[model samples]
Target: MTMTMTMTIAGACPGFRARLLLGGALLAGSALAGPAVAQDMPAPQKDAAPGLTKVASFEHQVTGVTVSKDGRIFVNFPRWTEDTAVSVAELKDGTLTPFPDAEWNGWRNAKKDQVDARNHWVCVQSVVADPKGNLWVLDPAAPAMAAVVKDGPKLVEIDLKTNKPARTIAFDETVAPQVSYLNDVRFSPDGKTAYLTDSGASGALVVVDLDSGKARRLLDGDPTTMPDKSVTVSYDGKPLRRPDGRGVEFAADGLALSPDGKTLYWQAIKGKTLYSLPTDALTGWLTSAVVPSALTDKSLSGKVETVGENGPADGLIISRHDGRMYVTAPEENAVKVRDLTAKGGTPTVLVQDPRLRWPDTFAEAPDGTILFTTSHIQDSAFYKPDAPAALPTELWSIKPGAAEATGSTTAPK
Candidate 1:
């Protein structure tokens, strides 16, 4: 298979397929997004790595980030430790604006009983700019990883041209149970289906048909999706845990699709091993006429291929520029690249800096710069009650191939 279609990580492995599942990626964008305004960047975290540049800093916990094909930059703030003012925003030329408008972001935790969580951005986890020129948002609607509000969980698609929601697919208790937190999503190249990861109490992959608006939750509680009990997440050279003695337990979080869309890979944030499966295996069962059964689910599970290890990662993306998979190595304060030329191999550090505290999510610009966020999970109130409710987080970028750091700019308004 060609590099465009397959990201073969190693030589021959136990389950490496002869005809690997791979697909095309999004169209390349034009230039590197402009830097955040100078005042927005605190001097302490500036130029923390060789080619790393600080783009923007936010008051709330910032998790997911995406660079649109036409060069628009968007980010998301999940209502994890505090009630976020704006759940999703656009970063343009130095200003960060509530995308679409403020009305969509007006939902508040204080007014949860009064407000309708169905239409508003409630605990948005990811913002993805699809190849079809639409921006999609995934909202688990479970604030602080707690109870899910009735009619809260949803996936929304907005047309970039009109800046209005084109369609929305709602997930009920069956698809997004109270314990599931839909984390991230990758759209198929054809724009017909979407794949997502549930990184909550029990882990699973949620597949949605864009046209039918039908969703199927697969691999629920499977070993590959759940957090590995043997793994321990540590930060600052110590095991990160709350006073009650809980280590990182997020499951099936980081997700990546092959450049060609034939392959899909994901791993748990509280676990290390990466796993992948052919898009065909997932979509094939989803579209079939027979009702979903345990036998069918087990058959699909057997098709999953172990893609080797990436120690405690949070986000993942296959770079359209170099065709290598980039992983957010949160525990290591680094970003890594898994060379796809090999069959099934290990990833090497691409960028590492102390400032990259929990490099959470990734989005590659057309110019090939990799932009990620430092969510600072270890410092959040969930782990440390003494921490400020409104946490300060920053957006960072890794210039392809270690170029001179782009000079800083003004902060977003």
Candidate 2:
């Protein structure tokens, strides 16, 4: 069976006007952009940490950020609202330049089997750098969060030495289904395998065998990967909802891997629970002919385990030095650090900053400084048509008082 889906713009969609009016009335006094300032907007809330500083700002919404071993910064802005002139950019000397070249950043419309699509970034959701200094760009090719074009979703690897694309790994429907929104990814220590979260229609973990360029979708529709419908997201004391009256419900968003490459951690954006599983269980299933029923069967011992979290979380990272898991709790406007080795200990606030509107991703620099991006997605035009003009997305960095550690050099999951 084959299926295709696409999402229309806000005004073009049916009943959008009515939805917009209702949304505007509900969000009447909410402050999204703050005073329509010509200069940089003031911090929504102050950072509790003293060392936090701004690295760069973008007019477009930036969801993912990663730093290379040499301290080179790269960020990705997904094509969620208006088409972005450049989806992926490199931050240098306080300015962003289209990565590699502008041609690769150019993607206008969805084309079926377009060869050039591999070169262009189509709705790139995340940017990550590997341990070997190679940058990987994951493009779900689902513009406006709609249906994906045929042969559009892919992972492009770029060699930093040459600043050119080293190879492209295209994903078929089996790996990235029509409704699949490839969210974030983390690589194995050896850089041989990558695990990604599908936060869209069908939530699952996608395991990619880099050597063979084969990708497999695992644990599809499993309880751990699905969103808990009962959980409601409250941003700034109000229920975070879209113009259509639907709350933000993303599933299986953040992902992380243990330093030893033994365990993988993941959680849904709309959920308060966190989960982990043995890496071997995922890779081992890839080689087995296990049916869907058997794979999702809870009775099948040695499956994933739940690691309960504080609240709705976005980005997740396990510190290589101490094995502490750092999670971004947007509801609390704080980052929570959990000791994975502890048996049911409460998460401690690593950094609580009112400026963190929607802390999305994390990238630990070689010097032990942690970098993250804030998109303020809850205030995006998709949810609030009357939202003030888009504010510049921010990139921030702070040192968590930890020495440099060894592990995969991927972006925040």
Candidate 3:
């Protein structure tokens, strides 16, 4: 049996210390389920702020969402649970059709050698569309957050116009290592480089060169990428913990790129602080003659800058229209917007709703609509083993005042 399955079985046991250790180890190791108890869940705020609308709902947990320039919506459901049939799918006319074809999504139970890991979507964490109108799928290759499949981790680029995969870039140990979990990714304005967050056993930033298909790991275990053990995430006015007594902890998640492709913004799920750094510093590390195997806090001392945020955040995105950064603050069940151009400016609540359980990722449409998904992560099986079997995950879209004012028709990079 897999370690994840063992952990799941052991976690359900009644011992306090053992269960606690198992749960904590599970949380430290990686980052799950169900039902239809709608009445038990918090009710949607009747007076929810305007400009918010529900675009779609799903029975499975969804954490990553991206919309193409032409308004083609795509979502990804991680294999944290047992029932994730489709890793990457397109939402068309209220139905989800597996992107490319069903054959690519049919590697769930196949043996590592029997399947073409590089060509198939083993376990997709995020799907993003670039400024050039191509969709890129990120697969960490670890199902149920277990061991990484051989030659499994990869970034697949698909041509939206043809709805067919254009290329596949497989990542090896140097870039993705056994412990690496590629959580989220953002592309540079020029689409030459891709920045990804490693939120698994260690925290780091993985930079990929699109032209050469070469990837380098930087800032490995850096303070900015690592989770602050001192910080505790709370949800619904209580410390967010698993039934086995482990606290929720995730490192180096949610990434956003500046309009000019100079600054990269990122934060940890278990941490309250936000951070940004010059893209050049990260890209420069690749060419350094004495590039260390792992970068320390001191190595990036002057290059990394901490940005103030209201609380812990998940998915983060910068608005192309107004140049503001939108952070999903699950602690307050609200989305906060900060003016990137204004120094020392505080983030303001752009929208709040009780139904915003845990907003995961952000995507901007050509029509000035900002799209996001609420996975209700705190209520998942990872935290509550007895969580309902049919939870409702929602995709929401809102046109903030900033987006409406610009009326920009440009696509997000």
**Candidate of highest lDDT:** 1
For model 2, what is the C-alpha lDDT against the true structure? Answer: 0.73
Residue pairs in candidate 2 whose N, alpha carbon or C atoms collide under 3 angstroms:
5-147, 45-355
Q: Give the per-residue lDDT digits (tens) of candidate 3, residues 1-413.
A: 10211111111112101011112222332110011111111222234346565555676778798877766668887777544666787764324667777777766655553468778878789999998989999999887667787899999999987989999999998778888788999999899999999888788888888988878888888888888897899998899998779887788998999989999989898888889999998887666676556656466646789877646888899988778899998887778888877766568777777778898899887655677899898888788888864455877777786434543122212
Order the candidate numbers by TM-score, best to worst.
1, 3, 2
Q: Which segments of candidate 2 are over 4 A away from where they belong?
A: 1-48, 109-115, 289-302, 388-391, 402-413
lDDT of 1 by residue, 55-83 (tens): 66666688989977766778888989887
Give me the overall lDDT of model 1.
Answer: 0.79
Off by over 4 Å in 3: 1-48, 110-114, 295-297, 388-390, 402-413
Which whole-number lDDT from 0 to 100 does residue 209 have in model 1?
Answer: 90
Q: Which model, 1 or 2, shows the larger lDDT?
A: 1
lDDT of 2 by residue, 309-351 (tens): 6578999988765678888888877777788887555677766
Off by over 4 Å in 1: 1-47, 293-296, 403-413
Q: Which residue pairs overlap in candidate 3's backbone? A: 32-381, 33-381, 34-388, 34-389, 35-388, 35-389, 35-390, 35-391
The residue-level lDDT of candidate 1 at 115 comes to 75
Model with the higher TM-score, candidate 1 or 3: 1
lDDT of 1 at 3: 20
* TM-score between candidate 3 and the true structure: 0.83
